[model samples]
Target: MKNTIAERIQDFLKQFPPFSMLSKEELLKVAGQIRVLYLEKGAYVFEQDEKCHDEFYIVREGAVGLYRNSENSQNLVDICDAGDLFGLRIMIIKKNYRMAALASQESIVYAIPSSVFKPFIDENKEVNTFLLETFATHARNYYTETEKGKRIDNTISIDTAKDLSTLRTISYRKKPLTCTADAIVKDIAMEMNARKADAIIVVDEQKFPIGILTDSDLRAKVATGLFSATAVVTEVMTAPVKTYAKKITVAEAQIALIKNNISHLCITKDGTRNSKTVGVFSNHDLLVSFGNNPSILIKEIKRVKKIQRLRYIRKQVERLLTTYLEQDIPTMHILNLISEINDALVIRTIELSLEEMPSQPTVAFNFLVLGSQGRREQLLMTDQDNAIVFEDVEEAMYDETQTYFLELARIVTKNLHAIGFEYCPAEMMASNPRWCMSLSKWEEQFRTWMTTPSEESTLLSSIFFDFQSVYGDADMSNQLSDVVFDGVNKSKRFLGLLGVSALQKPSPLGFFKQFLVEQNGEHKDTFDIKTRAMMVLIDGARILALYHNLKGINNTLLRYEKLASLEPNNKELFESCAKAFRVLLKFRARQGILHKDSGRFIQLNTLSKNDKLKLKRCFKPIRDIQEVLRIRFQLKTFM
Candidate 1:
């Protein structure tokens, strides 16, 4: 069944994203599944909100204009030239098209079946990134300012029959960490951690694969502060693990992850649960096949010398983030991992900057990461919020010390800007002279803010309070935390003000049992996820942590968990907050990733009913916690 026409199509695809990311063999496999269609000039490909087609289109000849029909006006927001991909929204998010695709001229396009492409996205992240970026670009272009929903869908889970299949087989890891079926889930999870493995297979006495437990499972159960880790392995494991022959085609492994809604598959000697385990196939293994690995990324980051190269690595991290999200890794873990990567990039940038300096630093200095970066909650590219803290010296040396670090901060911020972190619009960055100062000055500034809490002070508290040292003196960070804790303890009014700030955003739900969406301005008629849902959770967590004199826990979800432990009387409420925060973080991340934006806001109309319900379920705690804060802090005056 060799098709010469498909071969030509593959030749064209090899020059594009996702296709260029794939090997020659994999490219042809995708090409074979593509159904070539010719469109006369000005022909329609898909209409707005029509039930999604099973295939996504890529233009081969001519052009396509993705247009939205609103208020009886069809506005062409984006045009697709040859090789541009269109009509992928249906595949992602499993929703209908938000925009209609029309041939701008006579065109020939390759309709790649979603079935064939979905597996690739799960296995090859570059392909996944390509699809997501495409959807995000379209969403940002059209959906951001509009009430239009159904703009995009998730790229994974598309099912199309394979026609041009590659002979590629996914090689599973041999001797995967396994435990007896009766083993305690806590013990099993411990074994997994000890082995540095994210998954563990449960086997029968006969050494047959009976169940598989993955990181995602551990996250859904253990991380929520729900199930006891002491539960039996069977309690959390996906029972009757999908077993395949020791040698499984890449296509088969992918289909299994999708069909079973599972991340790990057991490869057994006889391709059945009755047989012995031979290896384990996981999404991580698939991603590694495409040359994406954290260890490798670290290596690349270290060796990269150019600012542009660091930018490139940061881009790779985006693709990596998409992979982790697709695998349903806990958002907290994803945040931590990506934060480490960001820290590394910043550290490397510092090294490069210092290497370029005329002389080494005369005294000790530390780099401070403020805001979301400071809290390790940052998952998307954001404005740089950082400062420089240098050692105190003699008055003569103070100016010299300031000059040296100022020059250093300028270089670091410049390099970081080049690396894709935009300059702080408010000039909160370290390069600003007011923020770049000796450690003693930072203490003075923090003390002033805490003692004299105001609207501006409260604003600064949200950013500066979460300072974590990315590089330099760890003891300085400890000292900073001590200052913050001492100030909050001494100023009870400050804590009350903080509590009021936490409750600033009212309950997410309105009187009509509908989401209280934004009514006007830039994000009109949309759900302000950050200002409404997530910030309420974050603010509540922050103020509670302040009240408890808790230090070192900055992430909102983790803070709630800490609150739960500290206030066992309200454990149920705190746990609900933690879970709600987790869901909101994931929701924002998906919206952000799909739109290539901050993911802080979302259009209500764009979400599915199930998604809406999931969101609504999280709001009860907002009301409950605000009540607790209101009574505890006597916030009637603030309200």
Candidate 2:
């Protein structure tokens, strides 16, 4: 009489997407045919290249690992935890499974046959749309346009299911002021003044955007006397305007403006210049959306002649970080946005420093950020680790050039300190004469470090090897990277030394699975998460990436993702390491924000049971990844 099991299935299914969009009756009908299956860890629900099972499955408990096999190895594409849906590909195509689904942990899963789900796809638009978005997100570049269209009609929509506030649809200026291409520049300028508008779109007879004219256009062309005020707008207007659909998200709009190097974007009906124009999205529009708008802060950083103003902006950045963390925004998104803002601060500081110089140096040089900041992973207001590398000058002029850059580095680092980044206690900064050098000297520095590894050189290499150019000539950074990789590629002894450095940090957990807190010093009875947990992952990632010669990838999370792709045999471990790193990073940031410090050391007693469990969960991967490094580098003898 009572189908309690089916009813329970509906409860779980309705909590997730696609099924969440389905009506009660529809979900019930689908749940009625669902078959509940239990899987032991390492058991596969579906195998790659096998014929579709006429069913799609969802994780009801534990986790499922989706793997794509290639080159005799299975790569983890994605891990689906509780309430996560997988196996949707069967509903979209009549082909074999492109990926295999296996239980990553002992799990319970619900399988709903396509026969019961196909009718709902045809009948419900929301369900269809949700599935379409899910498919696009998880697509591995294999699905054809026709195959994708089989599940839903072609229509682009912003994925609001994501957590980032920037992903929300933008509130752009509707009913934009428009003008014809033939309108006189004087008339357009006068009209813009009367309307108090900074910009106007140039539209064709059919209202399709052709170009745009802004105050900048008038200032550069009319005020500069390049064109007469009475000249036609076409003579001065910026042609080939960038257009996006009305549903463009703030993130998309921001990217369009930045990438195009424009102040405004025209919103069109069909997302093309040929389509009917609807509204305008200006740089100002972004300012009103988020209180701590990154673009606006960046603009302010660049515009502020005084360095003290940057300190205020940096404070706002911390507030933004707090908001993102409180709102549970994706950690990777937070990391990237903060990195960009931090970089803007450093770049602006460098720009202002150059202005204070007696005269511009003649040779090309690069301003590099070392350590965490260099990897684009710095979150909180941390210590500054930077260096300077200038073009090699004739031996006679070398001293003069080095002195100029050293002075420049001193100013930049000092200003950066004012903006909240503390000076590195080890004095590992650009201002250090040993760090500010010519390109050839820097190359030699890396060669020496790689050719002959020691405690001091290894420690310095750990910081300097992650150096990234935040300002100045990027070619210099690339050249240094080439030398480092060249030296590392040939040095087995150095790899072993680095591997030893990674294993130096003991396991975070003890024999009883209890956290190993600090034993003495000022941090007594506290946990040094940075050194024990985060660095273990960071070091493992860096060493593996270096061993694999993965150039230009410095961010810890990205390094792990790239490693997973490159070494599919160890994909699960790398993916776990990446996930663990994200969790640990976010945890540290939250702690730092709460205590108003770097969040490096944690008082274990302060943590709630759940918080402690989450921290412990992240440490397992740290231990597992360390073992991989030990075996891979043959560190037994060295240790």
Candidate 3:
């Protein structure tokens, strides 16, 4: 009397959407009517233009690729993986199949009879909405204008950045050739010939894009006999597909292609591989849309083989920065975009250095950027702060390993210097043996710094604690973060010491509420905004974040935002800190650009009355946050 197979199928169905909306009793009843089918790679679940089946399918295992036949070839529309629903089109339209569904791998599927599932659509509102949305997304505009539930947007907006057409939405090839991972190279090549297409995307069974095969791959692999035509496309395909969202701008697409040195990009619904592939963007697309502009400057930065050309590109970026400021773009937006550009420069520099090395690296490692650049808040070129953390190795190989990475770092830092970033005066660079070490050694260093609680260690912690992994293995960096939080948990004295350090910077304003100006050096009459104001806020956010054990939040503004969420009573004060930090950072960036130097000092006389007032208003949050740190850490006793 027990239907064991139906119960198993029911259990699997309940884990996914639509079915998840069904009651236990209802799901079991539906499951009893379901039929199970087994399929091998290349087996067809259904073929294009075939009459509708009596049931819809859900992949219980492996992947099912939905391919639309076009121009004598098949183009993959979407992939359905485990728990992913397919064959739903028949349920809605009661029409013939518009695409073929084939198993991309050995698979098991559950066929849920539409006769049983259709009642749920009418009875359960959640199931109806979910299925409709899923159907709409996968339809890829297959529905005509007269279709039910169709709505049009009449809203229009003025174009401010019309000249910057790269900001405009990209138009890509919607019908590029795509095939399953198990598809044959020879057969796909024949299909390409039939369609006169140059590229084919290789997708996984679950419909996520996994790799790409192009004419170049065929010439190098099949023509040269590196691989036989009968071989699966995965053998020669360029893998781990680069995916972008449908909303990706032309400029972003161009840079993404150039930066990764790839020719094609998969445009997905959500800009990640987890979503279905919607279209493909290629170099051919860029050729028409491309113009000589900021994006071109960035593209040149990535393409230039020589380090000297990078310096020229860096100058162009400065001009771009000026133009952005003049355009009055949001400061945070500018910060993020320019920071990405800066990161590109650094990442390219590392790539070039690796190529110049006599031999390849032996073990996994991570390149870390520290201080402002690490926080992704460096809008203006400042001193380079970086380090290296390689995977732990045997004691015997330590010296040689360190020497190799240090040499690599030496070249990278030298290249970065040539590209406008100055070297750290204190030598806090990966080239320094003290900063470049194995992961375990780095962990030990943090543990020692926290347990000892010295002034020097606290200074180093502040600098190094904010590190962001720029290249290589990110897991190494994550492990380092784990060590940092672990060390913080074990040492309360270090926490108090860090708190005292945050409070060490005096109030940005004097007792008379006047701007605190430097009394000595070249900036004698100018306010030391860097130390007097920004540092107070930065240190306060950093210390508070560590006290609450907030990991991975390094940017001062973001730190305040996260802290506000954690303590609602202090939310107002914390949000003010984030707002003030943003204002100060923008002010510093603007001054830096004007002077063509590090924006640390600001002359009080150059500002308008309102500018001066804005600066004073931003400082109140600094005083308040520092006081919060003092009381939270009982810093009065430590002081």
Best by lDDT: 2
Model 2 TM-score on a 0 to 1 scale: 0.58
Per-residue alpha-carbon lDDT of candidate 3 for residues 1-639, written as tens digits (9 for 90 to 100): 998887888898887778878999999999999988999999999999999898999999888888888888886555666667888876665668878999878899999899999999998987875675455334432221222423221111112112334446788888568899889988999999998777898876666788899777788789998899899988989878899988887656665665576778898778888877788887655644442234445555677687865764675566566656655666666766677678889889999999999999999999999998888888888999999999898999999999999999999999898777999999999999999999999999988898877889999998999999989999999998998888888877788898888888856788899987888887788888888989888888888888889888888878888999999999999999889988898888788865557888888898999999999999888889878888877888998
In order, the Cα lDDT scores of the candidates are 0.78, 0.82, 0.80
Cα-based TM-score, every candidate:
0.59, 0.58, 0.56
Q: Rank the candidates by lDDT, best first.
A: 2, 3, 1
Candidate 1 lDDT by residue in tens digits, 294-359: 554565577766665587567667766765776687777777778878888999999999998999
Better of 1 and 3 by TM-score: 1
Query: Model 3 TM-score?
Result: 0.56
Q: Model 1, which residues run further than 4 Å from truth?
A: 1-292, 637-639
After aligning candidate 3 to the native by TM-score, how far in Å is the CA of 483 from where it should be? 0.8
